[model samples]
Target: MYMKLKCFICGYEVYGDPLTNTQCPRCRGILAVHYTNPVFKIDSRGKGVWRYSSLLPDVGERISLGEGLTPINNVGEIYVKNERFNPTGSYADRSSAIITSVLKVRNIDTFTILYEEDFTKSLTHYTHFVGLKPSISIPRIDLVDLDDILFFISRGIDIVFDNKPLNTLVIKYLNPLTVEGLKTIAFENYESRIPVERVVVPCETGLLALSILKGFKELKERNVDVDYEVVAVSIKNRGCQLLNNVREVKVVEVGDREVFEALREAYEKGFKTKPLSALSLYIAENIGKSLAVVTMGFKTVTSRESAVKKLILEILSQGKPMTAYEIWKTKPIYTLRAVYKAIKDMENKKEICFEIVSKGRRKIKVYRLC
Candidate 1:
């Protein structure tokens, strides 16, 4: 297992230190945590983003808000990875998970960050998950959205407006940890073994596109056969040089009118996404059999959920209160992780009830038809 913070331009490497600095001391180039020769294997026992922990840097007990493993729906011809179900309801939770974990191991008590609503809120939440304090400085709080303002206030985040945060980490594109977090989307796609020729992503600053591309690149570096090419969809010819640096990235420029047209088409097709995400939808729809990442991804697609549920139903139809593990033992397909999520959903909707039993030494939650 090889891991290091690598400078893309100067090729300087820092091993075992993701936070040595976000830039190369020699060239001041952008740094990203690079993994090679990794014993990458899907840990089915692990939950959420941590399922791919083998590919990520070792952060001793990770802090998670159930960030990854969002559902990918095959709506019409386009496959969309919906991230709306994340803990903070944003993909930034993925980055927050890694950031908080690294901070925890480093024994960093307090860290300040420049506030960008989604990332700021996510980092604040995860930091508190491990009892770490974050002071957020938003230079344009007056211009910030009303709901976002209330969110910060509700969480008791320390916010400073229109001021410089002295020597604090800026949670912006240059952040390598952000790259580490965003790249897991590509890993999820690969592990799921979803066959698609192209994967499309919305490009604002190109970090998401670059991170995902780097992930696939790492896959190729480790001799894994990767099939799809990453396509960056933008409104204008609107991407930075970093996106161009990757020779394999396919860039698509869309017209504003065309975007709106696609927006309406997507709405009628029962897909609701922001204009940025609509850009990916437009490209994916035009080129059928493509998966456009809406925001996040999941351990296994809910496409398997119905089948797994049917099996669990048959097991519990006997009216016997069986433990979740007992139900999984009868499942001929789907991972136990999938079974767990299915029962959780069923339990939530009152389709299943717990038959608590006091055993000799252990108290167990047994499931039966409600």
Candidate 2:
């Protein structure tokens, strides 16, 4: 007889074949493979994420790219697990390989990979490594400049700008195999001598957060004393609001405009939280969610480096282009040669872009988006 499988969310007993229902009918949450014993110790014979395969669903054929044992660094008080060291320089590679493997088994070759701007390179890397083809979609606003477009094209990435595909796939984009891939991170954490007090994930979407929750639950069942709060950090403007609703937490939403305005107001007047709507909202929201606010300082997008991003931000702000001189006059601090050099470095790293426009006697360089 086949083993009985159950829904991970509602714990509903799945009576029929497991392949028929991949998700729970009650809560519509993703289904997890059930075993007779919830916990079991396995030999450390296997290398990388495959060691935790016992806890994850069986993939007919495993497509792996050495996606485990990333070095964990101690940065200040927090342990910074540098996922950038992953095969594709992003944490998504682990999950991407698994997802692609499943698709290969199912003979689903031509599938679209709808992702945020950040995941484009990572996904492309993994897809190529796994020998699969995928069409990627990102926001138009996210792709700021023509040079940015060139970069994606150079990487052989097919770009589309519609949310329909994402809406269709829902969480299935993170198939069971993908979630299982994420469990590797937790497994590593459990094996560590000093367990992490809190897990911080860069969340554009909530998939990683959801996977982390599952991984921790499995660790708990294994009798690992993994007591830590899961913190999902996101950009003030680009963050997905659905995470709060899904987690059933009271969340505060903030935007870049609000943050900048507050900063400007403080510089002119005084530094206080009362005037900044975003800062105030963030304070309350962070407290409610038990999240630590970590500020990331953005380098100035200057003409020598990425005139693209600065110009894009400018155009979006008021649908008008600003010359390098105008920009310098308006924001002199950002026009520094050092700032421009840093921008150039970022561009080489494929982080942003720059464009120059010619107008009469004076040529104006405009920084575009992305």
Candidate 3:
């Protein structure tokens, strides 16, 4: 093996057959992938996370759904790394890709997983693609999200409570491969057009926060010009144990109320996000020059709609709201009917919104950039 699993804490190395568990049973430390000749170069010919395959594990075959290379959007003074663009609509696709690729190379046919809403859903998608059967076991159904239940039911995924099935690997969130998958986010940020200073991520088990920090640390250790601080936001006091020993991260505890308020603010600003990620958004707003990593959103990121819609956005973006007739006047080349049609399309997509203005006894509608 060109790469060996090394303890993230003790630096103990394991060679030969790779272990499934990321936690070192000997030192009781977390494990990470350490390559013999680790390089930090992006292959432009490759797409998505595979571009950083130099820094990633040496899987025989890479099972990818074009996860990673998510957009770093500038919203006000903060930057947003939207991970919802992944094939599974979650950042877990990164881990799922690596996990399934490893399983395929090892010729493993099936696996059992502890049900985590986003991760399980994402894993199922990849498992289905790779022709692997996976059964999920839930710790508590009542505690599970309704959307997750429906998602499984809709996909006809198996839900078995107590069948282990011999020789099947039980996937865990703490796996070293999982970190190898998620740490690519830090690589993406480092390769961003605009330099990133601090990264704010929502913490559940502290795996994600640490994975990203390790990525930046690896870059710095390799003599790459990169400097980044990671901030882990947790709800109340949940999942602060793994982070307690890590001095590289700044842990922030937020209440449920603040998270919801931030969620509302996120939607209002057209950045729909989950409650866990809302904490990062809230924290990023309070700080300066930070990138908030949001795992998913209520909608997909904006794409080019049409030429007229693009022009209309430019006009409304530079100034106040304008009526459709006024917008047509700015670009007379486009017919009045075309401008009106573009406004309707943009309105449907929520790219632009409108408000009514009262002039004398008449009411006129004006469109503004959302």
Output the number of the TM-score-best candidate: 3
In order, candidate lDDTs are 0.76, 0.53, 0.80
Q: Is candidate 2 or candidate 3 better by TM-score?
A: 3
In candidate 3, position 264 carries an lDDT of 69
State the number of backbone clashes in model 1.
4
Per-residue lDDT of model 1, residues 1-370, tens digit only: 2247887666898764555467778776678887656866778767677888877777786778788887778866778887777898778888889888888887787668776656777788888878888777777767676766787788787886668645664455357888888888998888777768889988776778878887887777777888788888888766545665556788887888988987765554445667777778778989877888876222333445677778888899998899998898876476676688788889998888897799889999999988
Model 2 C-alpha lDDT per residue in residues 124-228, reported as the tens digit of each score: 566666666666666554554454466567777666675544432222343455566766776676676554455555455455666666787777877777775
Candidate closer to the true structure by lDDT (higher is better), 1 or 3: 3
Per-residue CA lDDT of candidate 3, range 256-307, in tens?
Answer: 8888888766654545568888778888889877999998764632432266
How many clashes does each candidate structure show, in the order listed? 4, 10, 0
Q: Provide TM-scores for the models.
A: 0.74, 0.56, 0.78
- Candidate 3 global CA lDDT score: 0.80
